[model samples]
Target: MREDLRYLLSTFTARDRFLLVMVVLAQFTSALLDLVGIAVVFPLMQALTGASLEGGILGRLYDVLGGGSRERFTIVLALIMILAFLAKAVLASIILWWSSGIVVRLQTTTSRRLLQHYLTEPYLRHRDRNVGEVISAVGQGAQMAHTSVLGGLLQVLSQAMSIGLIAVFLLVVAPLPTLAAIAYFAIVVFGLQRALAPANRKAGLEAQNAAWASSHALVDSLHGFRELTMHDAQGFFVDRFDVANVSQAQSARRANFLAMLPKSVLELTTMAAIALLVILSVATGSEAAALPTLSLFVAASIRILPSMVALTATLGTIKVGRAGLEVVVRALQEALTSGVDDQDPRTTAALPVTEAPIEVQQVGFRYPGAGRDVLRDVTLRIPNGSSLALAGPSGSGKTTLVNIILGLIPPTSGSVTYGDVPVRQSDQWWHDVVAYVPQDVYVADDTLAGNIAFGVPEDQRDDELVRRSADRALLGDLLAELPDGLETRVGERGSRLSGGQRQRVGIARALYRQPQVLVLDEATSALDNETEHRMTETIRSLHGEITTIIVAHRLSTVRHARQLAFLADGRVEAVGTFNEVVSASPRFARLVALGQLDLQEGPESA
Candidate 1:
């Protein structure tokens, strides 16, 4: 428990820790109030019977009320008790509200921070992790951490303090019964907790794993909807989902049952203690003398039993949520400790500079856990405002090279630099300078204008830029067809749009950035020949204005580029103008022939 708390605290900011300390202190104050409320009960009951007004709190009150008019004394005493109870209730409610707000706010902030962290995490970390797991950590993990971990711990502290204060009161009133009851309750609560500790730990882990598995299964099934529909393999994926979901459900059910067990056991024990105390008082022929003691014990029992039940439930919740809490804590820790520098570069303004060439100096890269490098000693230079086309066979590392040049992935050896600054060092300013159109564009369920503007907020979106970029990407026909034009919702993943339309949207989004460097990886693959040609022209128009890097799927896309590189394996075999590469390498010639391009036609010189 100490270690778990330390782990969680380490992930929290100084402000969070300070707020948590304040919450604990508030809980302590509430416990003291509870003790005061309970303490006033015994004397109040004695006053009601008019039996002992000459001792302790009752004596003090009697003297204060003039010790004369019995009715006045009773009425004033009752009001004092009522005030004590009201004070305790009010403070309890306030503390509950405050603590709840703190927990919920922390959860909201932590989840948002985690989402941002995962979105901006090092690309290598992303490649090595599952997307669904990241989602789980941000969603379910945050909920459990706040409720089961934070709320549960709070419950235990408050209840434990309440019980301790009540015990102290009982000791002052009647020490023997207090000692006996504490001994029995402690043994019972401890035994129950110890018995279920291992089971709770196991169930917590199982539930966490099963939840992640179910989420991953659901994501896979939905992502492969087209394939499943065509092959009638939906049942297989559903079965996997069912297995994971059932495991999660069963683990939760077991944990809940275990959590509730102690409540029932404590209730039974409480009733027994009440009955035994009564019987012993009668048996000892001391019913009259022990009436005050008996009342104190009974009131304390009523309070302690509930506190014990709450303590048990909280302990159970903490045990059950510990595993998920660990995942959440780690993600929060990662966000705090990510070596992206102490300051967030994403918010920094770009440096004022003229066109600068992108230089790839002996860059090499390998995926984590891979035996060999995918790119090795690869070097390329894209002169400012010039276009470079990448071409090769399927496994020729064309996309990998483009990604490196785009600053999406760091090289294992050497470096990629934008002008004088390393791309790694350039950070968000580099992202601002470059625009990318991937083969598979991610389209959100948003309006056409929103999609074109991409990450920019609606109020901040420039309508002129959207229309210009859309027109440049040849989206005029699609816009004309839409009833609402730019305002029309695209539906989830752009389901309302065709593959070619989606690609065009991707192109428009990239163009909207008005980047200094534009990279297209198979960006024209989905377009029909006429559209592809028009799109090629659109790209061609940007030449000698912004540096263009193209990883072409179709050989024809590179025919008119300023320069072309034919990559084989992970190395460039030939790099020159299209005609020059064709004459220089037989493989390049064969590819051009395969695409049915005129072998003798030469493009405009770079």
Candidate 2:
């Protein structure tokens, strides 16, 4: 627990730590003021009851003020008590504002850090983890951990101090009643802790799991909504989400009951204690003799009882939030432990990446925990200006090889180098040199120009460059049809655009980067046959200008490439021209017959 707390705090920035300190001081200040406020009532009560104020510090103050009437002195003490409460209220407001800063800072900062960690993870890590789990951890888990766990801790600290200071003040006023009240509340708190702590912790963990489940069900189902509707299985996802939500609600209900139980239990038990103290006081002495003590006790109870209930509730809430805290801590620890290949990804940016062949040297890769290599002894080279078509049957390590060459995944037993320098050494410049377009293009909710110039600020975008890139991707038709042309809003996730249009936008995005190495990972798969032909021509036009690597299931897409690497299973069976590959591998011959490679008008492969 200690180690986890330290790790959690380490994620907080120095500014957040300073804000936390201010909150602590505010709580302490509020508690101290409460003590003063409660303590002042005792003197005021004594003065109102006609008790002699001619001997103590009150008498000295009265004498210093020319022995004012008892009424004026009583009024002065009452005013001081009012001022203290007023000050506390104002300070409480300020503390709330400061507390919000810490929570927001912690949530936003930690969420961003986790996001960066996930984004920078090697590609295989993404493959191994569930998308919804990562989504929940980065968004929901982060918010809950900050709002509940850290906020609950603050509540506990603040209330505990209030109780302690008030208890001390009460002890001085009436020792026996104070002692009995303290003992009783302590017993109740201890009993409640034992009864509710395990349940609260369990409920918290249950809530976390339910959140994960519901998040997974919702996101996964929404993404596959079309398929679910076609299969008439929408209720399956609905039921799954309902079950998770029901569990989440049940856990929250249990926690609420536990928190509320203390308030009532403490209320009745405290009222009983106060009544007994009053009865004993009156029975054992005259009412006049007991008035001052009774009055003091009543005032103290008014302040202390609520703090005690709040302290108990706060403790229970902290237990509930502990589960989320554990989740957040584990995620952060994983991100830390699974270090990136490039310690500082930008450190080698200044080292120039010379235009030379991209070399794959004795490369062998096996996914983590896999038994065999996906690519074994794979040696290949693509000169500065050449196109290599990665062709294979499904699951032939074609995509993996593309990823390895693109530095998205590192080979387990080999290294890729650019112009004799290791790729890892020039990762930043490597990124600037390469641009990739996946099979399913991701379009953000932005204007057409913004989508083409993805991640570029609106003010910094070059209108002409956006237009040129879009034209290169054959988006002229799309641009002309749009009412607002380049400025038209693309709906969320490109909901307004067709799949092929989004793919074209992705192509245009890659083109906008003006990269030297272009990787199209089944990038044109969504296009119609005619569109694919045109795009293939566009790709062919870039021959000997931009070194292009393409992974394609369609033979027409790779018909005119300079080189072809045909893979079978996880091995590269042949690396040569189209006719040479067809002669070398029977699979290529079969593909040629199936795809009618010779029927297409194309240049002879290099």
Clashing residue pairs for model 1 = none
* Model 1 weakest 10-residue run by lDDT: 339-348
**Model 1 lDDT, full chain set:** 0.85
1-606 per-residue lDDT for model 2 (tens digits): 456667898877687787788899889999898888888887777788888878986677667656678998888888889999899879878887879777878888788778777777767777788877887788777876887778878878888888889888778767877888788888989999999999988988898888888888888888897899999999999999899989989988998998888999888987888788778877887677778778877887888888888888878887887877787899898888876332544343553765577998988899888888889888889988899999999988998888888888888887888788777522688888888999989888889999999878889898999999999999999988999999999998898999999999999999998888899999999999999989998998897778899899998888688888999878889988777788899988898898766733445632
Best candidate, lDDT-wise?
A: 1
Tell me how many residue pairs clash in candidate 2.
Answer: 0
Q: Count the backbone clashes (under 3 Å) in each candidate.
A: 0, 0
What are the TM-scores, per candidate, against the unseen true structure?
0.96, 0.95
Worst 10 contiguous positions by lDDT, candidate 2: 340-349
lDDT of 2 at 447: 94
TM-score of 2: 0.95
Question: CA lDDT, every prediction?
Answer: 0.85, 0.84
Q: Which candidate is the best by TM-score?
A: 1
Per-residue lDDT of 1-606 in model 1, one digit per residue for the tens? 566558766656899889989989988988887787688678767776667677777788689778877677877766776776688789889988988988888888778778878777777677788977987898888888888888889889999999999898888888888899989888989999999899888888988889899999999999999999999999999999999999999999998988888999999988998999999999999987788678877877887788899899789889888887888877777777784333444585755455899888998889888898888888888899999999999988898888787777888998888887888623777888889999999899999899999988899999999999999999999999999999999999999999999999999999999899999999999999999989988888998888999988698788888888889888888889998899898988898888898866546642
